[model samples]
Target chain A: MGRALSLAVIFFLVLLPLGVGGSTLFQLPVFSQELVQELLWQSWLQSAFVSFTFTVGLILAVCYLSLWLGQRITAGLSSSRIAPLLAVPHAALAVGLMVLLSPSGWLVRLVHSLFELFPSPPAHWWIADKSLVTMAVVLVIKEVPFLLLMIAAQRDQLPIQRWQTQAQSMGYSVRRCWWLVVVPALLPRLKFPLFAIAIYTLSVVDIALMVGPNTPPLIAPRVHEASLRFSDLASLEAWLGQWLMIVLGAMLFVVVAINQTVYRRFGLDAIGRPNGHSAQRICSGFGSQLLLWLCGLAVLALIVQSVAGTWFYPALWPQQWSLGRWINEWPYAWPLLQNSLWLAVVSAAIGVAGALLVLERQRSQRKKALAWLPLLLLLIPQLPIVLGWQRALGQDAGWLWLLWSHAAFTFPYAYLVLHGAYISFPSRWLYQAQSLGHSPFNAWLHVLLPQLRGSVALAFAVGVAVSIAQYLPTLWLAGVSYPTVTTETVSLAAGGDWRMASVYALLQALIPVVLLVWASRQGNQQRWKSKHVRN
Target chain B: MLEIKHLTISKQQHVFLSVESLQVAGGSVLTLMGPSGSGKSTLLKWLLGEPLPDFQIAGELWLNGKQRDQLPIHARKIGLLHQQGDLFPHLRVLDNLLFALPRKDPRRHQAALEALEAMQLSDKANAWPHQLSGGEQARVALMRALLAQPEALLLDEPFSSLDTALRGTVREWVFAQLKQRDISVMLVTHDKEDAPGTIISMKELTHA
Candidate 1:
């Protein structure tokens, strides 16, 4: 199983690229002579490498620093207690950040309105500039919460009180106990999550497209545009761009591996709380409050931006608000909304069912492949891999193919959600029913299904969120002929039309909200039913 | 040294647990008895002043002649142990003992050693909490609490989960040590066998 899964991965990376290259090489008009040179210059692959290195390094440093500073102030932070940040989709966040930080962004306007001290931005502003700093900033803000959540989840499982009280009793403050005892223990467990964040940073497409440099964007986005939009398989340059991204992705794997080896050898993250930013320290201390503020502010801006029919910079609020556009938008917007919801539901159902089946059966050495594949899927540059499939399949057979690809991605996440709960579920209850002469299937249906319904509901909601947030697959696989909330939002956002982007963002945010609310209600019902049974 | 006056903990205008008045002078044990779901744990939580947010608490609690209800948790001069004994499962028994004292105290290690020796758990000093038997966990939890030198300790069925053979030995030792230290204690239990001195049933308290 391991060998087969590994071969499958290798085939996509190696053979598929060669296949695309060969096809382009043989094609008449699509293969341009200067494609490689154009890629080196226009694609900004070198600049992207520099920018990626800066963003990944700074974000990793900030993440570790935030954890240390948070541990210093208090040990109260835990992953399960994080704010609604979990539910706020990634594309939604990037759009929000764009609205806040753009040259004509609300923050710039707000400052201008209040103080009038700062000069207006030049025609060519730094937000999404060639430097890519704005993208870096947004990436840090988004990834910080994720790292905090991941660390806190594992940390909570450790014996916090025993360690805290033991250290505090010996004349140490709460901060000391957390730093000296708790942090060292948490570091080893945090290795994979941090790696996930790094790969995520490297391979991220949506955020980079929204706030990153366009003339020369992140490698992932470059692959996305070339293969998906250009649609000229004869374009050897596009295929060449895809190949370059795959190499960069390969380099990231090496970087993470070497970092791991060096870490284990020298124990670099083993000690010392380096002083991070004081403001960031306060933000970490406030914990959920900070997350809520960022989310709330972004949401409020999106709402405002959506409604303002005609509004200029340096205005605190819209001068005029109109429902006319909203009414006009609904006809065009309704279909996208319906498609996104139905697709999410269909994909989530299929994804969760597949997860349940995979988890239920016992596998031998194949389980190791299962473990590696999900993280591999997570770390990989998604667009490059999909370009191979699109190149292979030739422009998306139908919506069913889109649904299938979305489920394939969504399966890992849904499986992760159900896995911990499924494994820990009491086998005794199922066994006891079977011993009483009920068939195995009946016992499972009667005992396990009801018990697992809550997890299934939650997993289903997560699967939907993953689907709704998808940008490239829906755009590339379904083709622009079929639109989802994410595709509509990004396209409008890229066009510099805040009003239309805001409407799509609201609808995008709405789908997840509806699913989560329903999931939560299902959870409550399950609890109430269990209690009623006991009574 | 521990007093709970006019304590009535209510949830959404529905009373869950209430006690008009109660006091345990120094060197005494007040055993609180009740069946499951009868709010025995609720009463202990209320007395410790960290009751669930869902419940409304109205009361005055004084420990060692000071009003403690308004004090922060660490400064309440009160200690708590639950059914599982709640030993810092990650720490060794010795480390757990040392956790009771501030690090600056030069005698913290020695004090921990002495305390373990007195409890006749000297051999298990380096053992993790999970390595110990239920009886040993209870003893360690109790010793850890006492070492903090709390004016009062609220034990919520601390000994009920222990094996029958080890219960009597640990229970007798616990009562004797609290009396020797003059630390007031309230032990909430369903067992009649655990009555150290005066036993006050929770049902009786609610009626009063």
Candidate 2:
């Protein structure tokens, strides 16, 4: 299973882009060329700054918030709940939020229906009112859980208790220890994921297209518009490339500046006795609970909207509920769902297998030449590399190319999650297995794998979540010709019809939500089962 | 003065440490010695900090004439050296020592260099901790704690990871260095011979 998955991943990574090239590359290159070449250095530079500032600001805010939230969550709740919450798709979340915010949305529709007593919808635009608020909110909701999960994972490895105690003994307060010691250590490890989130937020097309300012939408959506519209493909590609370069440069500058500020403020020692907060009530337990409750509410809202038959606003619940949308969409949804499932499953399976191989190889090798390889996918922004790979491959058709594209995205997360679990496995168990004369594979299967079921399940679940959330790869490599739920949802959302769009958006989120729910239970069950087995 | 009174610690419902009383004044040293699993380390952890909550601890601890029982670890103005030289892996030896200095200390780099010179390790200032010999890393860890100018120091088998010959030398150097600073020292060890001051044997720990 491992070998086959590994081979599949390698093959896909190498061949898929090449496979997709025939149609998009040779047959329609001229049509797409103008879209690809439109580079306005001034506008590109301006948006780059916008994206850089927004991204940096967002990451720092999230990092600070993570410091606070991580402490509260660990002190209060179990990490088991985190996975299910994190498993929700970014696109579906943006769509749901757009629903709540758009004037014609559930929010405004209700206002018009209840307050004005209007029999018909209002002509005025309400929520996404030419502001970045909707986009920013969507990004925060989508990104925080990921940052939190990464921190939780990192915390599992750190000697948090011991260090906290030592810091306290040294006259550092709990808040200080967290700020000075924990945050610094945790932040650096988290930088990659945080960067990924920042880049994704800046470059997100689907979400931005759904709710971001339209007339002159964000750079990503504009690029998409340019390509699909065919009036200016070359200009779009140059604009994208130049915007990428500028954004990357600006991001680097801001990241450095913030890093310096953090270093100067916190100093060399990450652990310090923190000064107590005079105003600690920014978000209380009640507020966080509310935030979590709202996140739950968001999921419920989407799930409910996915099933709702037409109902006007002001009602607390949808007046009608049916699976007619699911029924009508099944034939279309089936092939797409199958494509999505196979994509997620294949990508996840391959990613896990690839990660394991690299880890095992690293374990056996005396020299650590490419220890940073797995981190590349995790840390580097996907926009440039994926685009470059697409250009390099020249395009082809086949599952091979599609699978490869997904692997490029999935493998890093798989490596990070699985590598953590692999390293955390007690050496004594392996020693015992060796002493028992068990071969490495048998030892892994019988001793290590069984013990690592929780971590493995968690890693696999995370891998699935990441693959499911992929918008770029599914669109880019699949040529937007194949209508995966993500592609369909994004396209439908582009057309500006909330009711029908919500249906596709919710459908896109369904499998991953189910997978996440299952993964969470499976993780807990595996953890429980392992304990029983050991006992 | 450093005082720990009627301190008790339990892990998974099993009592690890139940010390009745222990005290060390300015320029004094207290050695806590017991067999492995007899709560010697647990007592050191209680005095310094226990990062995990797997254990329940009941205690009153005073440091430098202040009631520090409720003070968090960093605010307690205490420093610790563990069995492994837990130097920040990413930092050079000088920076590792420099990291322990107070934020407002203008001469942190100079102080760290001086500390390295005192340890006869000035040449290794730019070297990573892993690049240093085990004995050298031990000296750096010792200097890092001392340079912080901690009011008190706890040594949880700081020299335990060394070879026998190196262990004796590292222990002698460590205790001497702490003594030179007039810092109160609390040492926890399985080996009684390493104790330099009054020993607290928890073999007869009472039910507090």
Candidate 3:
């Protein structure tokens, strides 16, 4: 039974999408040479440049921050702050960033209020509302927490603390030890996550739609717009663009793989060797704290925008603050909230269950040959595979397909979250329980599950966040009949209705944040109870 | 009594250890001393009815003159103690004892409390496994195992993790508790001092 469930999950979630996508590649209509060249030079190159910049910037930022944070803060405190940022939806985060970085946004207003530098909103601001820099900045900010979490998960398996101690004993500074010893070890483990981040940055559509440049928008948004037009030429163009994305994704994976290997081989020996001089310690205590504060300020900006009245340029605070927008928008927002909530809850539950089934089946097997197979969903860019699902299900598919799409994406994350803990758990505990007279099933129920409750809860919370952040699947699969908060937020934000968009974006960000808080609290309570049982 | 007959433990059809017959009468221990990788722990796992997928074994286990090799681990009515005590960390000291008692016993809570009292741990009924000192954890583990009322028990270097002073104390206390229950025991250890009676070296047990 476990084998069959595992096979079914692999088939439906991993194989089916890839198969559909492969078929879609073959069915693309031929276009003119000039058009291909135009897209190649115009859309694809621009998107690639932005994606390349974003991926490189994100890698540097996350590595530096992970090292800096690892040196200063305890893992528990850092994770407590960083993990909640993962719950914020990508589109909502982009909207919040827009509220902060736009010409007439908060930063400019603060500057004007203090130094009177900007009499009015700067006409030509450095970080424009729709520019490549803004898009890359937003992507970097959002992805740093995720990669940091991935590194944290791998830290236990590596002897990072012992290595740090050994290196520091040899007269290396803490920062030098991390760079010379820790980062080299970590880069190899971070390969797949970096690939996923690269694919995501290259193929993200909603964030690009919100903040990316307009004249020849990013490739993902271009494909999205073309696909939505519902014309034969547009459909062909979308498929062609998707084909291009697949090629780019494969190329990017190779580049990242080669980068990891090269770094591990020569970079470690040459640059990572300890020099005679002790590296000067830079005061870098505030990296993760700064990120947490930025996330907080983003949420705060959203809150203020949602309730503001006459919030003009160069004004630090709104002239008036009222709950009128909430009152007016609540009627339209109600169903969207319900849709987003139910979808996130049901999909996250299914995703977690699917992950458990696969892990259980893997445990029973002697050889875990394809242990990383499920995570292929993450390595593949969402655009092509989701486009494949759209093609297979047709434009008029039902709500179940939408839910399935959400679970398909959420399952990999849930699996990634649960895999390490599930695999490392001592099977001897179950044996001990059985030796004490409980049946195998009873032993598992009483022993293994309780021990893994924290991991399970966190996986479920991550699944919920993944489901809440899904914009493409919800929009492409369900359309207007089942509009979700994410879909509504992106559309409203793109349509220049910041006030109404903030209302939906806040709702979008709130569900996952609340679930994450509740899950972490549940985990903390279990730990506290086990450690502090009374006499 | 706990007995093994015609026991052959081999890997890939190469017989490494063969025992014609061995027995431990009730209220006594048969100690097998060997270095690491000498199949001492593997023999104990087989006695405990753990599935050893990497080995080929042919043996008949008899507990009190009944052939018990076909029984599952739970039904074999055998207990095991490892070096680290392996107490259930999620359960408090009292609940760990209670988990070993029969579920249908109406006074199971009182039985558990009495067991703790016998170990001079009545005041620590609610303490977590991590809160206990090493000697206390070893004592609780022994008490928990004996409370399960197993037909026999296997000790896999159970006292090896303690300090030299605590080791002798815990070992003596464990043997006293088992002898008081009149339970059969097979102890595998590398330390000759850990064996109290009838020591069998691995070289004597292995086939040429």
Please state the interface RMSD for every predicted structure, separated by commas.
20.5, 19.0, 5.2
Residue B42, candidate 2: Cα error in Å is 26
Best by DockQ: 3
Error at A173, model 3, angstroms: 4.2
Task: Quote model 3's TM-score.
Answer: 0.91
Q: Which residue runs of candidate 1 sit more than 4 Å off their true CA positions?
A: A1-48, A58-62, A65-83, A118-131, A165-192, A228-234, A258-270, A273-283, A361-370, A419-455, A517-535, B1-208
If chain B of candidate 2 is superposed on the true chain B, what is its TM-score?
A: 0.90
Clash count, one per candidate? 8, 54, 0
lDDT (tens digit, per residue) of candidate 1 on A384-486? 6666656665575478888887887778667665655565554434432332233557646656776667667767877888889887778767756678888
lDDT tens digits, residues B102-163, model 2? 65778877888888888888899888667777899888877777766678887777777788
- Candidate 2 stretches with Cα past 4 Å from truth are A1-39, A75-78, A104-131, A167-173, A229-236, A239-243, A246-250, A253-284, A319-322, A363-371, A394-396, A526-535, B1-208
- For each candidate, the alpha-carbon lDDT, in order, equals 0.68, 0.66, 0.80
Look at candidate 3 and tell me the lDDT of residue A378.
77
lDDT by residue (tens digit), candidate 1, B11-76: 899987777778899999888887788888777766665426677888899988899888645567
Worst 10 residues of 1 chain B by lDDT: B83-92
Cα lDDT for residue A396, candidate 2? 44
List of chain A TM-scores, every candidate: 0.81, 0.82, 0.90
Model 2: what TM-score for its first chain?
A: 0.82
Task: Give the per-residue lDDT digits (tens) of candidate 3, residues A437-532.
Answer: 989888878887887787788888889999988988888788767888888999998898888899999999998898887766766656654443
Return the candidate ranking by lDDT, descending.
3, 1, 2
